[model samples]
Target: MTDGTTQPKPPRPPRRKRVVLADSRAPVTVLRTVLELEEQTSWAEEVVRGFIRTQFWTAVKLALLVIGTLGALPLVFFLAPGLSGVTVVGVPLPWILLGIVPFPLLFGLAYWYNVLAERHERDFVDMVEK
Candidate 1:
């Protein structure tokens, strides 16, 4: 079992160095517009006020439309009294107009308002982010 010649060990592979992608000590800067908004500067305040004014005017217009349309129904019925007695599927015309019509009208108005409000908000955000 004893061998006179001794065998040498295989050579080892070379080690590789690690590489760094980013430096943590680098300086970071904030945008001027963002800083102004956060600090409530005069410029930022004016911009925000303008956005609110636009939204307020939009709401007022929608409110007027709703009021005018619904308010005119009663006046129309009063002017043409014969129309009030008319029936649809045995239900009074006035009842159907007053009860059923307003729901769809209001729903449509609400959806329109939502779309307008979201558009305004999106515009505001884009302005601010820029």
Candidate 2:
């Protein structure tokens, strides 16, 4: 069966690599081919490195978000009282403002936000990477 387009198909035969000597008459063509292959390899390596950089930035952004969340936890509590009635290191529940609750709270919020932020960043990175 043939489609609307009329085109002649070429026949395929041998599928093997023939070793060419250095002093072959078509040696120049072989050298050109080698250079083209090298260029393609270099381009591929650059693309790989670009992808790596994108991943690296994604990690750094996540780390900063985690640190910021942990650091700001105290501020969140300070701005709004009646959140927790637990004393933390010589400080009143949250009114004294002496210390920012325990590390667990900070760590928890940081941990949670870090994960959330990473998911968001990853979504964005995925959209851009492609």
Candidate 3:
């Protein structure tokens, strides 16, 4: 118990050597569907055509909705001539309705379109992957 000498430590185990099975410089093969898509095969073109059609219809619907909402404003003002006299914070009711209101409405519609578009793309990708 009174010895001043310290005991030597045990040897550690050897480290594992990394073994690579594949050559890093070799060209990797792409998936069949991915290759088809890139090469624009008939099947791939059809799938892409369907996606474009869906997007076109979506844009058309949104455009119609915007047209309907904005288009109705002028008709409403014309029908109710008394509305022209109305004002909010020194700005005419028509001015606020036409200028301020459309921004938020358009923004909301854009957000909706973006969500639907992303969903459609996601679905398309899933279908392709399968």
Highest lDDT among the candidates is held by which one? 3
- In angstroms, how far off is 22's CA in candidate 3? 13
Going through the candidates in the order shown, the clash numbers are 0, 0, 0
| Number of the candidate with higher TM-score, 1 or 2 | 1
lDDT per residue, candidate 1, 1-130, as tens digits?
A: 6588778888888788788644444323326676788899999899999999999999999999999999999999999999999999999999999999999999999999999999999999887765
Q: Kindly list the per-residue Cα lDDT of model 3 for residues 1-130, writing each as its tens digit.
A: 8599888888888999999765555434326676789899999999999999999999999999999999999999999999999999999999999999999999999999999999999999887866
Model 3's alpha-carbon lDDT is 0.90
RMSD of 2: 15.6
Ranking by lDDT: 3, 1, 2
- Local accuracy by lDDT, each model: 0.89, 0.61, 0.90
RMSD of each: 13.1, 15.6, 9.4
Q: Return the top candidate by TM-score.
A: 1
What TM-score quantifies how close candidate 2 is to the native fold? 0.33
TM-score of each: 0.75, 0.33, 0.72
